[model samples]
Target chain A: MPKKHRLKRVFGAEERQHQTELLYNLTYAQSRRIGAVTVKITVEIADFKVTKDSDSVITTLNLGSCVGIALYDPNRKIAGLAHIMLPDSTNALDNSNPAKFADSALALMLQEMTKLGANKAALQAKIAGGAQMFFSPAGPASRIGQRNADTTSRLLRLYGIPILGQDVGLNYARTVELYSKDGSVVIKTAGRADKAI
Target chain B: MELFTLSDVHYEIMREIGNIGCGHAVSALSKMLNKKVGMKVPQVKLLEFGNVAGFVGGPENTIISIFIGISGEINGMILFLTEQPSARVLVNMVFGTPKNTELSFSEMELSAIQEIGNIMCSSYLSSFASLISKSISQSVPDMSIDMAGAILSVPAIEFGKIAEHVLFIESVFSTETDNVSGYFVLVPDLPSFKKIMSALGVD
Candidate 1:
């Protein structure tokens, strides 16, 4: 049995209880402890937005050959995440928002984050996901995960957003969670411990 | 317009054809999934695209629609899914899970389904190609999960008549302890429709 599934089976019951408690705490604290925390984050195709009033985790789960961007502003403690499925907008049927693709998503995300009190210069990022889940022996273009990761890295460099951390090009899907309350980000991959930043 | 009619012999031939087509599809799925998938040759019937939803029964009628084109020949929609459980089972089987797990689509499941859809659609087309002795290709299949009525409610185009021709087949499969069902929907172009109908004596 794979480590993740085995762990899940062994700790599934206990984890369920903990998850329930975590959800409860997050829900209750959103109002009581996290003052003015609205948890208001929009699930945009490519870009996401967050504000200081948001105290809830913003995330997208199980990204396959898709790039997920998590941007945090320590000054304002606001974070945003988006799971981009394709590399470019040209392949998509709806291209109204080019940002829905990897290249454009990062550009739009940085642009929006700056508008929401995020410093363009001090904007830190931790990206995870862009896994080659399919059985593709062919390199790069055929591998959407590579394309997603490559596109994200290229765009970030072009725009000059310093990448603080990265975990990309794996064979498993990952779930991303952003803690708006403290500007913390968590990435959970198959058979691996949750990494936080 | 004189509606086409099928003779008893033609019906039997077409049913066999449907079964063969479904079998080829299951074979492709088995290869792609790299697991044992037992699927019975579907039972084919002619019905209005609207009424077709009723035959696929469940508490909440949901259907997944995909569009496939035979390059420049036929452009048709394929819809399936008897219920949510069936969809889950499909996702599980495609992932090669031996023990039945409560299937929830993660990112892997989405891409897996896209590839499976491609294989199944190709299998179905190949089977039809053999019977008709002609070539057929399909576009990338689109996946949508919605209430049957909502999926089929495309205003005035309900009665299968408007669509050059329609073939409805039910596919049944079982995994470990769970048994599930789905449908194979095919819409043939005018020329291919006439060929199939004529071979079956539907005129």
Candidate 2:
């Protein structure tokens, strides 16, 4: 195992608002992002992108599957989220529509953010989702969640962008929040409260 | 007159209709995923329509059942499954890698099943809509990683009658990298059975 693959953890609720570090528990709203113009991106079998200049983008990647939420806040206030499933759309798309894949989803999200005053060069990214929610020996397509995470990271690199932070490749589903106001995010998983980063 | 015979054109038509309806579902999924999904028409069996659970032994045969239900003018469940090893393969294909193996039993073990179920159910229902020519909506899928028997028992099978015609369709989806196989079965009442047979040019 490489040093980079080691799990990374962050301590939460040490400072800031009490509301910032919500205990990760199921009884709560699961995961949330508090900010203006919150664009909620939900991924089913399909991927979608939402951009907002006011609020952050809140997306849920629950257990039993893999989901990738790509949030870009180039202005540090304007944010966008792309809830993506499959890693590649090559097999998932009809050839006429390329934006359906993870790589395409990120491109589209960035394009949207750019339209909303986000600088492509200044764009910083946070990626969450891509859990090993299931073990299928069949191959990568069966573990769409992992594919979501891997493909997302790959696409980000292809565009010559740096990933500042990522919480991915776990065995649990996660809910992600992108706060546009402060350019922070909170990830909540089962049995734990929300932790903002 | 033979009450129950192959010559009973209605049964034949019902089988054909089941194949057509399920084929649409396969076609829809194939188009969306850009992969070919194969299907098999269900062999008609006679059992208490309502006692489907008893016949199938509910949770016993089930490894994990992931499904979503649609409640409106019509109600139906979309489901998917695989034996343990098969599930592993299915998961890897979906996630685009090999299994982590370290935390295979964790909650993450259910993600692939749920995701696949969601896709299948949505496509199946959409296909059904085309066949019936009726508008139908679906609730978000409810996925459960439970014993096959337990999940099967959740639905009461005793609402209808015994020995009604049932249709089963099996589909196999093969991609350059992997393959997925699934089945679709329809249990229609007698009158509906007759209508289906006529639709299939059987009766």
Candidate 3:
């Protein structure tokens, strides 16, 4: 498909090889036939994925104090998912990866989604994770989960992207999946029922 | 100083800290369980934030973690973690429950695990404190059963604020019949790290 070709053209040789390896890793990536072939793309920590393929499902796992944001353009069926680790990029030890911070991750995701022919005005967002896995009596660092969720929500508002759904800020970890076909978000946590939002 | 800039001597000192600290902890665990507890030599490493989760078992692996924050003389975070099955085994050993019995982590079981974490961490910290002659205090232990990556993110985020590289001391402790290997992770802040090195007369 043209979308697949575009993906190959967009990623470098090494990144393409990494994607190929991910595809072949059946334990992490699951494929299904839903009228058309569907493939899952895993967005690891500090990573993001944007695609116009309707049969693509972008997922990020084990979001504890981190946050996952999913953006979808209804008309064009373009989707983006970012697994953001920190609230801000300022004073970060490593700022090379734009997807690692809430502020920059949204900016990068929006740029990539627009490049994939998605209408910026039609983009809607769903967010998950930002859970407080541990309680600490220290300073702000103990509440980093709440900070990450707040920062991501603020950035989304700045981008004029309406947040359609969210499941954030609990004492549990989450795994999130964003479906491009229907712009739906599913949240999974251990010992809990999977939630679709 | 940057973690990468640390020389071999610094690493060796850190490793010794791990060795002494974990040795004390394993013995405390042995006393509690009333059985011989075996341990591997502690390892000290400087790792990227992303790679820290892989040590416990890939990022997504399910784990039970106990988190304790250290303050006063040496500021840092300490974590004791094990896979779900290993957690069950450790808890059962404490309760004298049959090894094959399943655990749903009832309130009593959860408290037992927390107490074990408290004892082990305090023993480890006490040894380090006495070694440096610095007074340190630890926060109450908090427990979570979740994905390793998620649990590890707490320390990773804290360390990320000061450096791209995270320095950690890890020790694995096991028991007989069931190899209930538990990992002890220590992440000290930059200033505290410096204090430790200076206290040990390293630099």
Candidate 4:
């Protein structure tokens, strides 16, 4: 088991309780954040952020068929994110940006996460997005979302990273916020309750 | 993929195509609403696939969208978008739903709006098809109320897979009164874009 998931068990009850209290306190402030520093990964940008501070949150929006991945290293108290759009970059003729493909984005994000005191071997990932919005193009666009999800899963597995949770494949659009403190992924879909995956 | 470029003439042709197509659409809307609607000139441009949502409003703004997949001589997507309040007014006009309330639309209201969207898209397609002299048609309309980013991503991904850039036209639907307002977005595939440009003698 990853040491990050077992952090609460290893710590004493009082210390764990205190940490949970602090997190709970932050949660309320997170809702009505008057002055919080938020980094947003906009469409098509494969940006990664690593933070040791518990106060910062990383967010990505409009995840229709695109996938936003959150990887956390609990032992190092650091987290990273990548919003990848396409399943394969190898077939791309000119889109050379590493963040545009699952394979390349995962590779880049892992490198950056390790740079921030995260252990490559101890990383756990949570994913969201990859929905078939419409049954168009017969099979191409309709199936691309599933292919993106599969490609993402295949690459993550290839690196030996364990997936902690996922909320994917639906017609609704989603916006994702990854909390740095506990690596919780908050997914918001319109007219639907928020999910923490 | 070779970089797709549009010249000044090609750009103007696209704008005209947008104007003619959406003019028919808004006329259909005006007749439906029994209100005199006004519009701003269509804005046409080539955009990066990632930036398509920004063209609508933003990613997170909650809005109602109607999507139609166009395929005939040219292939692309046509989207009709409006804020919830605007949609409420439209629904009220169509289905006699109560106004100034927070109540969601009933199934009848949803289908009424869908039918309205179907008429508007058909008019838009017919106008453009006549102008280009191409046999253009549309798929069934898909309606949803969600984030703009999610809705726009359909065409963005379609265009992104083949090329990093896509061409879209943005047209505003509005009036002197605040009762009705919305946006009509057109995204044409690369081959169709080329075909139109070639038809207009813009090599």
Best model per lDDT? 3
After superposition, candidate 1 runs with Cα above 4 Å error: A1-30, A33-47, A90-94, A137-141, A190-192, B1-23, B26-125, B128-203
Per-model chain B TM-scores are 0.74, 0.63, 0.96, 0.92
Those runs of model 4 whose alpha carbons end farther than 4 Å from true positions after fitting are: A1-46, A52-55, A137-140, B1-4, B48-51, B97-100
Per-prediction TM-score: 0.51, 0.43, 0.88, 0.84
lDDT of 4 by residue, B1-203 (tens): 14455567777888898899889999999988788888889998677755677865777778788888888778888888888777778887766655456547778777877788778888988998888888977888878787887787777777776766656788887856756788888888777778877776676
lDDT of 2: 0.50
lDDT of 4 by residue, A95-121 (tens): 667777788888888887777778988
Query: What's the lDDT for all of these models?
Result: 0.56, 0.50, 0.84, 0.76
Two-way TM-score contest, 1 vs 3, winner: 3
Tell me which of candidates 2 and 4 scores higher on TM-score: 4
Candidate 4 residue A30 C-alpha distance from true site, Å: 20
lDDT of 3 at B123: 94
| lDDT value, residue B45 of candidate 4 | 63
Model 4: CAPRI class: acceptable
Chain B of candidate 2 achieves a TM-score of 0.63
Proportion of the native interface contacts kept in model 2? 0.00
At residue B79, what lDDT does model 4 achieve?
Answer: 82
Candidate order by DockQ, decreasing, is 3, 4, 1, 2
